[model samples]
Target chain A: MNYIFHFGDMWNARGEFVEGALMTLRLSGLAMVASLVIAILGALARTSGPKPLRMLVAAYVEIIRNTPFLVQIFIIFFGLPTVGLRLDANEGALIALILNGSAYTIEIVRAGIENISQGQIEGALALGLHRLQTFRLVVLPQALRIIVPPLGSQFILLMLNSSVCSAISADELTSAALDVQGRTFRAFEAFIVAAAIYFALSLLFSTAFATIERLAFGKRISR
Target chain B: MRSFNAGDVVYLLLAARWTVLLSLIAFAGGGLVGLIIALMRVAQARAARWFAIGFIRVFQGTPLLLQLFLVFFGGDLIGVPLGAWLSVILGLSLNAGAFLGEIWRGSIQAVPNGQIEAARALGLHYGQRMLRVVAPQALRTAIPPTVGFLVNLIKSTSLAAIIGFVELTRAGQQLNNATFRPFLIFGLVASVYFVMCWPLTIAASRLERRLALAYKR
Candidate 1:
């Protein structure tokens, strides 16, 4: 048990670590926005669109949900080039994250939407709201309230999933740790530092989500 | 360079057996550990409960990739040297246990307090109450989420590839490197996973419906 722990290498590589963490944030943030958009559209399609469109969305969700994210990244990063749609590692990673994230998001949002009572939509229609207005004004706000907590957790999960992007050589935190470990041969210390940084990031994001929840739904619920 | 062939597909399909094996190991190990964790979470002792909470938090907070990396390499650094197979199983089991423990804890709590009181009035002891009354009902509630987590666990066994365990994903990488046909190779890889996981998803939903019928008012 005479293992010598070293943090000096990690300290010297702080710049790379910071850059990597920021890349993780950026990648997750961008994918978060993209996936939310896709999820909302996919959920809406599943809920009220034509039968064919709903089936299409359902199939997409099923396929994505059933497969591994690493394989999805590999397919996009490598497979897309064969069709003349070449993308860099970062772009490929972001697309994979969004594709995977949105499928779960669609299910969550659909559940939220379904949770709204039938009377609410009928009441909105009786109040002279059009179908679009009824959905926008009456249904969405309530669904968002029900959806926020799980959605926040999913976003955190997305942040963690971003680590898988390292498989394709994305310059994110996990890849940076791997690079450091290769250079310093301090795999243990390198990953420990990366794990600690990830823990901090999770805490930070959870607090931020709590604040957002308060600001977004606090007053409405309190009333 | 060789083009993709039937041999490559056979290589992948054969390699997928390792993926299935790793998943089974994770599920069995995780389920055993998770039951302990779930019980600890519900234990009256403050220390046991806090330890359970800390375990869930640490595992859930960090990436499974890092956990796998740590176990695979850290074991060597400490001279224990769990090779790729043992390391992958250990890492995936720990992660899955944390998630399953939490899911089961929720299901256990969801069981009606009235049922517990009824068991108490019948003069049942703690073990008898949990085993005969509570656990059966909690199990019904636990099945859907537990199966769902198992599906996710199967997909995650692919991560074992990073530590040089040549499962489905790693086998695909090898074939892709040699053939240089990513589309055909990776697409075949994904379909193999889909074939494996889609049945589990369907089974979970069927079980959910059966449980719903059993509980219907």
Candidate 2:
């Protein structure tokens, strides 16, 4: 088998690839932060709010979780324009990412919250800690620790799923690869390079999350 | 503007049929290949184990979207004869096999060592012990996660639309191009997918509980 060594072309395109990687990082980072906030609130509401509110939040989680993120992006980017809620492709894609990420996050956070022992809640109440304060100070911290690894994996998955934004013309890493490949007509080489870049990014983000988990939870070796 | 049409709805429903067919093909094909990989990883030979591990690592390390593009374009480059249906099925099955293999390996290991030892002491051969003693219990543990992954596989099939597969999402895109009614078209698309996936999700949870209760009893 012969190989085309196009180091010159790949070098010239390095700047474009870097720019696309930055955009991918920005998109994934913003989506992760936004979904973290939404998920906390959604999880809390689902666990403790009134019946109607709980049901509404549950519905939101189930609907988003069950549908494909690609379909959601299509709806927001392409479908929303018909309903007079037009947004540009990037905005639409970001919204869809946050919405989809939050659904999975809600489940993760709720599981964490539920893992807090009832005895701890009783201890807090007996000590006269307010309900909200107990949750904020005690239960949440422990729960977050329990949920950290899975949550990290979820964010990595989110970064990979962010490739769907390319389908809506968001011009991130995958889209940039598409453009370069079209211009060069070296589709195989372009995709191989692109897939390697994505795999590297995933490893980078996973390491970053592991560091963050260490910082947040401190080193308490349970095992 | 064209008025809302029942005919469009009928077309979307028909497209959903392809989505179901693609999911079945991927799941069945993936399951068979995954079984081989799982057994290979479980084999006493280190070379077989390492080869299966490397295969799973390469596929699992990459995203499904990239795999789809590689298969679609690589088919063109190599002069492989395949339509959208065959290409998507081949790509998704390979991806699913890697993941499901790892999942089953973990589940199989979760079965205690004593059970296998006891099976051997009872004069069972290695193959007989695995088939009669180990596999049945691992399969029970595997069912829930396997079902969850299958639901995910179904959703992932929507990516095939990018390569011109006329599944549910692609059909919605076609209708939207014609009617210029993105909201109605994609809303219908998302709902159809939700309807297809939600049952599996529920079934997975229920089976998980049942398995847990069965072992407890």
Scored by lDDT, the top model is 1
Error of 2 at A54 (Å): 0.4
Instruction: Give the per-residue lDDT of model 1 (tens digit) for A1-223.
Output: 7799999999999998999999999999999889989999999899989999999999999999889999999999998988899799999999999999999999999999998999999999999999999988989898989888788889889999999999998999999999999999999999999988998899888888888888988853321
- Badly placed stretches (over 4 Å) of model 1 are A219-223, B117-124, B213-216
In model 2, the number of clashes is: 0
Tens digits of per-residue lDDT for model 2, A88-172: 8789879999999999999999998998989999999999999999988889788978777788788878888888788988868
DockQ of 2: 0.63
Quote the TM-score that chain A achieves in each candidate. Answer: 0.94, 0.92
The sequence of per-residue lDDT tens digits that candidate 2 reaches over residues B85-146 is 88899999999999899989988888999998899899999889989999998998999999
RMSD in angstroms between candidate 1 and the native structure over all alpha carbons? 2.2
Cα RMSD (angstroms) for every candidate in the order listed = 2.2, 2.2
Any residue pairs clashing in model 1, and if so which?
none
lDDT (10s digit) by residue, model 1, range B96-153: 9999999999989889899999999999998999999999999999999899888899
- DockQ of the candidate models in sequence: 0.81, 0.63
What candidate 2 gets wrong by more than 4 Å, as runs, is A1-8, A211-223
